[model samples]
Target: MGTPHSRRGNTRQRIQDVALGLFSERGYEKTSLREIAEKLEVTKAALYYHFKTKEDIVISLSQDLCGPIDELIAWAGTQPRTLATKQEVIRRYSESLRASEPFFRFMQENQAAVRDLAIGDSFKERMHALFGLLREPEAELTDQVRCITALFSMHAGMFALQDVEGDPEEKRKAILEVATELVTAANPPNRRPVRPDSAQTASP
Candidate 1:
């Protein structure tokens, strides 16, 4: 048997998953805490032990989805700012988005509700931090736009490619490729580190 703490953690995750599904299906505004508890086959009191309100559930879900992003931002901050690092950021970001697709879908489908929620501002703040990490302060306007577009491409590709026929992983790869290209273009040749092999080949 699982320990009491482990069991409680499982219950909390279950509540988050079921709540997101209900929120997606019925719309965040229409979905209630009671409905989520009913879907989970648990009592409202039991659900209350985990989340007191629908907004609380959404906030918890947001935190869970955004946690990896926060970590990525911190990780990027510690790395040297280079084209290679920026591309890796794009790759890792795409993976993070893949893991949290459902939460993102909810945000896309329920724009008004998401805007009204506190997570909206929080999410935007994280994006700004990420953008700062990707773009140089002295970079040209066009290059800066490329960095921003690189990030936007990932989000757009997730939903935009849904109706198209292709493997999901393949689509993600294609999106990552485009995002990588954008960031690479944004980074000038002067800024990219010279590979040892390239340097050797160029030697007389």
Candidate 2:
């Protein structure tokens, strides 16, 4: 039912999946491009055609996560800097992480490797971009903290609360709820008016 291009895309995705599996099972340092090739039942050259190295595979996999984030930041930019927009940003951001659960867990366990890959710093920059979207230009330090904490709760909810008792979906909802409350508090109607000109917070 799919076209040739679609099927080729599927092959690329399969290679990415097998690579992540190898990366997760064996440590990042332990996994090799050859092992990933073996697991995928492909030639080392074929795998190389798809990805040059382990770092390339890791970057490719996380690129899936990055796309939604860039989209969210872009979408939030077009919105009025209202409490509702901040809440919507939180909601969209949570949705973005839905597929990154495993990759994020790997990140926590492999902070050194992740740092080496330079992903951690890029991720922090994204968080700061989101913070810029959420915080008023003249926001007080306390409100700024609230906005930052709101973003933190959303991110930490995934990895930090993995062992918690409730359902994963429920936990996500709770985190969104908490984030929304914080954003709302930070932008009180009597105080922080939605910045009309801030519709586009930052350029792509």
Winning candidate number (lDDT): 1
Error of 1 at 150 (Å): 0.8
Would you give me the overall lDDT of model 2?
A: 0.79
- For candidate 1, what is the TM-score? 0.88
Give the residue spans of candidate 2 off by over 4 A: 1-9, 192-204
On residues 134-177, what C-alpha lDDT tens digit does candidate 2 reach at each position?
A: 89878899999999999888778777778989898999998889
Q: State the lDDT of candidate 1 residue by residue for 1-204, as single tens digits.
A: 222344355889878888888888889999988889899899999999988888898898888788889999989877778788888889889989988898899988988999999998999998899898788878899999999999998999899999999999999999999999989898975785543255357958
Clashing pairs in 2: none
Worst 10 residues of 1 by lDDT: 1-10
Candidate 2 global TM-score: 0.84
After superposition on all C-alphas, the RMSD of every candidate to the true structure, in Å, is 7.0, 4.7
